[model samples]
Target: MRGRNIKKAAYPYILWTALFVIAPMFLVMANAFSAADGSFTTANFARAFEPIYLAVMWRSVELAAVCTAICLLLGYPAAYFIARLRLKSRGALLFLVIVPMWMNFLLRTYAWLTILEKNGVINSALEFLGLPKLNLLYNSGAVVLGMVYNFLPFMILPLYTVLEKTDGTLVEAAQDLGASRAGVFFRVTLPLSLPGVLSGVTMVFMPAVTTFVESNLLGGNHFILIGNLIEQQFLTVYDWRFGSALSVILMLIILISMGAAELAGGAGEET
Candidate 1:
C-alpha cells in the first residue's frame, strides 16, 4: 500500500515529462522521418549531412570550441579570485556575475551590437583619441565575443561552487609540506576543481554550438552556422523534415559531447 502511494505520487512528474519532454522529441523524430506530405523519407538526413551543411556544422563546432576555451580562461581566474575573497565581498562579486544573466539574452546581444557597431561606443571612443575605427562588428570575433559574454556566467558559477566548497585543510597541509603556491594550485587545487571545469565546459560549449541569435546578430548574413541553418529550414523554408533531422543530429552530437565530458571528469578524479 505504501509503495503504491509512492508510485501514485510520481504519476504527475511522469505525466509532465511525457507531455513536455518525451512528446516533443517524438514529434521531432516523426517529422524527421516524414515528408512534407506525410510520406516516409530519409532525404532530410541526407541533405543535413551534405557538404555545405557539414561545413556549417564544423564552423559551429570550431567557433563554440574557441568560445568555450576563452570562457574557461577568463572564468576560472575570476572564480578562483572570487572564491578567495571575504564572505561579503565574495557574495557581491558573485552577484555581479549573475546579474547580467537576469537580463534577456537578446537584450544582452543587442547591447553588444551597439558596443561593436562601426559608429558605436568603442569606435566613438577611438575617434575621440584620434585612433582608427576597428572593424569589430559583423565578424567571427564579434560572434565569439557575444557568446563569451552571454555564456561566461555558466562557466564561472560551476567553477566557483567547486572552488568555494573545496576543503581548506588539504591546501593548508600541502603548504605545510613546503609546496609552493604554483605547485599547490597545479597539483591540488586544479585537480580538485576538475568536475567543475568539465561541467563549465559542457555548459558553455553546448549553448555556444547551438546558438543562432549571437551568430545572426554579430556574424551578419554571410556567416551561417548549423543553428542558423536549422532556423532557416524551420521558419523561412518551412522544411520541417530537414529542420527536425538537423535537430536530431545536433541532439546526438550534444549527447556524445556530454558523454565525453563525463569520461574526462571521471579520469581527472582518478588522477
Candidate 2:
C-alpha cells in the first residue's frame, strides 16, 4: 500500500513530463518528417545536410570544441586550487564563482557587448593610453569568449565536487612511494577526477554547440552557426519543418557525444 501511494505521488511529475517534454519532442519530430502540405517526407533532413548547412554545422562543432577545451584548461586548475583550500576559503571562492550565474543570462551576455564594442570599456581604456581602439565585438573570438565566460562555472563546479571527494590517503601514499608532485597529480588526481571532467565537458559542450544568444549577439551576421541557422529558419524564413530537422540532427549529435563521454568515464572508472 505504501509503495503504491509513493507511485501515485509521482503521477503529477509524469504528467508534467508528458505535457512539456515528451509532447514538444514529438511535435518537433512530426514537423521534421512532414512537408508543407502535411504529407510525410524526408526532404527536410536532406536539406539540413546540404553543403551550405553542413558548413554551419561544422563551424558550430568547431567553436563548441574550442570553448570546451578552454573551459577545461581554465576550470581544472581553478577547481583544483579551490578543492585544496581550507573549508571556509573553499566555500567563499566557490560562492564567488557562482555569483555571476545568478544574474540573468541575457544580461550577462549584454554586459560583454558594453565591454567589447569598439567604443566600449576595453577600447576606451586603450584610447586613454593612446593605443588604437580594437574591433573586438561582432567576431568569432568574442563569441568564444562569451561562451567560455558563461559555461566556465559549469566545468568548475563538477570538477571541484569530484576533486574534493578524492582520497587524500592515496595521494599521500603516492608521495611516500617517491612520486614527484607532477607525477602524483597525473597518476592519482586526474584519474580519479575523470567522471567530473567528462561531466563538465558534456555540460559545457552541449550548450555551446546549440547556443544562439552568444553567437548572435557577439558574432553579428558574419558567423552564422548551426544554432543561428535553425533560428533563422524558424523565425526569419518561417520554415518550421527545416528548423525541426536541424533540431533533431543536433539532438542526435548531442546524444551520441554524451554516450561516448559516458563510455569513456566508465572505462576510466574500471581502469
Candidate 3:
C-alpha cells in the first residue's frame, strides 16, 4: 500500500516530464528530419555542418568555456567562505547570492545593457572622473559578463550545498595530524568537493553554451554565437527544420558532455 501511494505521488511529475520535455524533444526530432512538404530529408543536418555554422559552434564553445572558468574561479572561494561562516550569517550570505536569480533573466540582462551602454552608468561615472569611457557593450566581454552575472548562482549553490554538507570532522582530523590550512584544503576539502565542482561546472557551462539572450543583448550585431544563429534560423528566417537540426545537435553535444561529467564525478567518488 505504501509503495502504491509513492507511485501515485510520482505520477503527476512523470506525466509533466513526458508532456513538457519528452514530447517537445520528439517534435524537434520530427522537424529536424522532415521537409516543409512533410517528406523525410537529411539536408538540415547537412546544412548544420557548413563552415559558417562550424565557426559559430567553435565560438560558442570558446565563450562558454571562458565563462565556466571565470565562474569557477570566482564562485569557489565565495561559496567556500560562505560555507565556513556562522550558521546565521551563512544563510543570509547565501540568500544574497541567490536573490538575483529570482529576477527575470531577460530583465537582468537588460539591466546590464543599461549599465554597460555608452552614456550609461559605467560610462557616466568614467566621464565624471575624466577617464575614457570604456567600450563595454556590444562585444564578447560584455556577453561573458552578462553570462557570469546571470549564471553565477547556479555554480555557487551546488558548491555551497556540497561544501556545507561536508563532514567537519575531516578538517579537524587533518589539523590534528599537523596538516596546515592549505594542506587540509588541498588534500582533504578540495578532493571531497570535486562532485560539487563538477555539478557547478555542468550547470554553468550548459546554459553559457546555449544562451541566445545574453549574446543578443550584450554582443549586439558585432558578435554571433551558435545560439544566435539557431535563434535567427527559427524566429527570423522561419526555418524550423534547420533550427530543429541545430537544436538536436546542440542537445546531443550537451548530453555527451553531461555523460562525461557524470563519469568523471563517479571516478572521483570511487577514488
Q: For model 2, how does the per-residue alpha-carbon lDDT over 145-215 read when each residue is reduced to its tens digit?
A: 99999999999999999999999999999999999999999999999899899999999999999999999
Which scores higher on lDDT, 2 or 3? 2
Residue range 107-223, candidate 1, lDDT tens digits: 999999999999999999999999999999888999999999999999999999999998999999999999999989998999999989999999999999999999999999988
Stretches of candidate 2 exceeding 4 Å from the true structure: none
What's the TM-score of every candidate structure?
0.94, 0.97, 0.95
Query: Residue 94's C-alpha lDDT in candidate 1?
Result: 96
Kindly indicate the candidate among 2 and 3 with the higher TM-score: 2
- Which of the two candidates, 1 or 2, achieves a greater TM-score against the reference? 2
Rank candidates by TM-score, best first: 2, 3, 1
Residues 132-246 of candidate 3: C-alpha lDDT, one tens digit per residue: 9999999999999999999999999999999998898999999999999999999899989998999999999999999999999999975888889888988899999999999
Pick the winner on lDDT between candidates 1 and 2.
2
Clashes of each: 0, 0, 0
Off by over 4 Å in 1: 1-10
Instruction: List the pairs of residues colliding in candidate 1.
Output: none
Best-fitting candidate, scored by lDDT: 2
